[model samples]
Target: MRKNGSNGGRAKYQCAKCGYHGYLQPAAPAARYAQVEKLLAERNSQRSIVRATGVSRMTVANLAKKSAISQPTAAAPAAEISPAQALGST
Candidate 1:
């Protein structure tokens, strides 16, 4: 197969023998993506995630941004008051 440029960031290949053309499969598998996500969820730094997962820094950063946007913000916990405060004694 010969290189036929890229489409949507994926490399396209053309078969020299049979005239077949197709995009190359992703280099990283789904499990690798999951592992990256897991590391991100654990609050690991993007650089650390890249080093640990062997994924590119850009990939980790993109995933982190995507995850950040998708997840909803958590509400802060309500503060507790002492019985005396509640009774307005102080």
Candidate 2:
């Protein structure tokens, strides 16, 4: 399955199993945001989280903001009024 290029450069390769082509670039740094978020939730400092997770401080901050935005928060429940207050006796 080896064939030389028409330009006389290096030969081209085609995979029969996966059909993958060209160079595959590495993923972005935010890929480890889960770990970063875990560390952030541990009350670790930004610098400490960066040091432990090897993620840039800026990226960590951005991911933290994104996580916060995605989370759903529950509203506080209303307090029960006393019977005296209800009867206007207070």
User: What is model 1's C-alpha RMSD?
Assistant: 7.6
- Please, what are the lDDT tens digits per residue for candidate 1 over residues 1-90? 999999788889999999899987755667898999999999999999988878989989998999999999998988999999999997
The segments of candidate 2 whose C-alpha lies over 4 angstroms from its true place after superposition are 1-31, 81-90
List model 2 lDDT by residue over 3-39, tens digit each: 3243345455555566644433346655677788888
In model 1, where do residues sit more than 4 Å from their true spots? Answer: 1-28, 76-90
Residue 37, candidate 1: alpha-carbon lDDT: 92
Score candidate 1 by TM-score against the native.
0.53
In candidate 1, how many Å is residue 37 off?
0.5
* Model 2, backbone clash pairs (residues 3+ apart or across chains), number: 0
lDDT of 1 at 44: 91
Q: What's the TM-score of each model vs. the native?
A: 0.53, 0.50
| Candidate 1, run of 10 with poorest lDDT | 23-32
lDDT of all predictions: 0.90, 0.72
Residue 67 shift from truth in candidate 2, angstroms: 1.1
**lDDT accuracy of residue 51 in candidate 2:** 89
